[model samples]
Target: MTDILPLAQLGRRIMVTGPTNAGKSTLTVALADKLGVPAYHVDLFRHLPHTDWEPRPTEDFHALHAAAIAEPEWVMDGNYSEILPQRLARATGIVVVDAPLLSRYVRYFKRTLQRQRVGALEGGKDSIKWDMIHWLWHTRGTAEAHRKLASETGLPAVFCRDQRDVAALCAAWDLRLSLS
Candidate 1:
């Protein structure tokens, strides 16, 4: 899954995806800030206002996302699941930030309490749902699922074990490129 690290060219369109609260947004923002690329958190256009997250219309959300990635450079993070194929076609690189289930659970709550200021979609409230939390672990990809993701993307995706792996990649970005 090292395909995500820059090779001959710096990626112009990058997709960051993982189970919920796996630091997808954090990494996307860091890369976007350093690379001067537009970053879109899929949840921003996905969830409804406040605590009720019924999600926006699929067609409308996909259209908006399509427009965002149509730019010369962009970073987007989320595991929309349904539209991954469409996203993969446009993604020059992909980062899959997978963390331990325990870690995710810990973060799930930390962020929940911080929701008043730091959690959830920027404009949306930090609403908690039992099912969503369950899905975070229960529905997350396994080894086979990950392999499928790699196959589907048809591109090497950098597999990050956790947040530290992400930070290391960002800090050693130039070194990785030189090796490539």
Candidate 2:
């Protein structure tokens, strides 16, 4: 099947996965709005809210992730590979946002400069860090892994190769985005 799936082909439980700064959260919110479902971010479950990006306990994160997936209809974003299998099993469809590594780096830098964004950690400040820069570089190939996972799982998936593709998909799906 083609990677660009029609809106009708997508089911209620949609999973959005991508590398850092790839706009997964933005698309997730947009999809949830279009589908009239709740939106969940894996990051929100991974880290404690109203904190300085501190991580929740591993067990706590797992519990939150599991509970969120148990919900019937939702758009969940993020690719915590450790819990991917569980999420994938519950997800009805997938959207993989893949952009060039350079673009991702640029976006990461730009996002850090912004005070607020769709995927920002709650009450956590955004700042440039060597670890994050290294992460963006190291996980450059995550998009391919996400695509392979979708194919192996036989889930209907829509792939966005760049910002242009994401824009086109949003347009085709008639998604009204809150943040550009």
Best by lDDT: 2
Following a full C-alpha superposition, what root-mean-square deviation does model 2 have from the true structure? 1.6
Q: What is the C-alpha RMSD of each candidate to the true structure, in Å?
A: 4.9, 1.6
Q: What local lDDT does model 1 show for residue 31?
A: 69
Sliding window of 10 residues with minimal summed lDDT for model 2: 1-10
Return the clash pairs for model 1, or none.
Answer: 1-157
For model 1, residues 1-180, the per-residue Cα lDDT tens digits are 243456324377878777777777777777677677787888876765564566888888888777876777887888777777777788887777777777777777776666632225545656567987888768555534654585576665677776567657766663221100
Off by over 4 Å in 1: 1-4, 7-10, 116-119, 174-180
Instruction: Indicate the TM-score of model 2.
Output: 0.94
- Looking at candidate 1, the ten consecutive residues that score lowest on lDDT are 171-180
Tens digit of lDDT per residue, candidate 2, span 81-111? 8999899899899888988899888877776
Against the true structure, candidate 2 has what lDDT? 0.85
